[model samples]
Target: MNQELLKLDQVSKTFRNDKGHAIQAVKEVSFRVMRGHSIGIVGESGCGKSTLARLITGLTPLDAGEILLEGNRICGLSGKAQRQVYRQIQMVFQDPYSAISPRMPVGTFLTEGLVHFGMISRKEAGKEAERLLQMVDLEPQLSQRLPHQLSGGQLQRVVIARAISIHPKLVILDEATSALDVSVQEQILELLVRLQKEYALTYLFIGHDLAVVRSITEEILVMKNGAIVEKLPAKTLVRDAREDYTKQLLSAVFSVREFQEP
Candidate 1:
């Protein structure tokens, strides 16, 4: 019995450049994320994947259509209403360093959301932060250190911990592992899989790498020029993708992998 957790109905966004040329960053995209399922959106840069994520998270205004979370309208809500809706959604960006405050201690960063949302007392936040760090397989003591003191992988783990701290219903990962080393990326992916199972989480993973996206998601959405050109099961994408654009992406990824092999 699968449940629908998030829905985007003909969602669209447009941006104007310096010359006032309209750019349809996201154009009438529609999708549904089932509860406790992982869906990946993959495309090259400037293909509107990130913009779509922003629209879902309510960070950007939509030019058309609606976004719903748990059957409730999430877009265009005001102040407290918006914050309440957003608390159900969390995002992990490509750069962990840019996602977190450099000046804030790691523990504070992890627990701030909890405290702000009244999930825990200030005194209890320390222990909760440690627990969150442990959940991500990071050292509890690392929570006391600044973001700069941790490695890229460690910082990303911290960011992930923070995102899950409030127990969001949908987690949007926008190229979350692209900035890490290959070995580190594997570790992070493993962590994500574990967390999703443990928390009964739903993921909306966005990235440019086909292989990586296939490895993590149940279904893959192929985006090109602000529209989804293909949607297919992850296991069959390499063999069954229908769109020419999707086939080209697979070819490109295969070629890159071949070139990198020993």
Candidate 2:
């Protein structure tokens, strides 16, 4: 039987805007992520996908809800406890340039987490960093270069290498490939698939693109207006989706594809 890796029970979050207006970013969202499974959360911008990612990663606190990682509550942890939880749950954000520091060498960025967690000594990090780069299909020598010296795809690969270097149980990718061109995006997606199989890593992929999400995940969650409007298998999304919002999203993707075709 597949084990449960993560669970969110009635998770909700509300943010106060500049004018003090309360915005319900996430509303009673509940879901389960099975070990070694890939689940995708798909919606348009402002549909609360990113907020949901933050909630899972503990970057943002929840107003009312429980986030359980391996059956332990992770919503309200602090200090050392929180840091420990973070080691098991890593995140890759939308913009690779912004996710990494401009001044840091790629190798240091890849090995910093491993060193901080005492997984490896400072002297051992260099070889391990090179190994990680190779795992991500990046040239080991590129690790000596700064972030600006690498292309967007290469930098994103580095970010991914860093996330997995510590052997995290779950990875939350929030628009991870949206910043790259189509070709680069495809390559990254393939790399993620291979990595997942190699490491038995569970993934929570958040993105606005339906096709991309479907290609990578086993199940799909459709969100609209801060709530999950539908949940269905990725293989049958178009055929199984019943929500009007989901159909609308499908229509939009189809229209865009048609427009782009010769």
Best by lDDT: 2
- Per-residue accuracy of model 2 over 39-113 as CA lDDT, tens digit each: 999999899999999998899999998999889999988999999988999999988989889999999999999
lDDT of 1 at 85: 73
TM-score of each: 0.96, 0.97
User: Which pairs clash in model 1?
Assistant: none
Q: In model 2, which residue pairs have backbone atoms overlapping below 3 Å?
A: none
lDDT of each: 0.93, 0.94
TM-score of 2: 0.97
Model 2, position 109: C-alpha lDDT score? 95
Clash total of candidate 1: 0
User: Which segments of candidate 2 are over 4 A away from where they belong?
Assistant: 254-262
| Candidate 1: tens digits of C-alpha lDDT, residues 1-262 | 2999999999999999999999999989999999999999999999999999999988888999999998999998889999997789999999999988899999999999899999999999899989999999988999799989999999999999999999999999999999999999999999999999999999999999999999999999999999998999999888889889998998886455567888
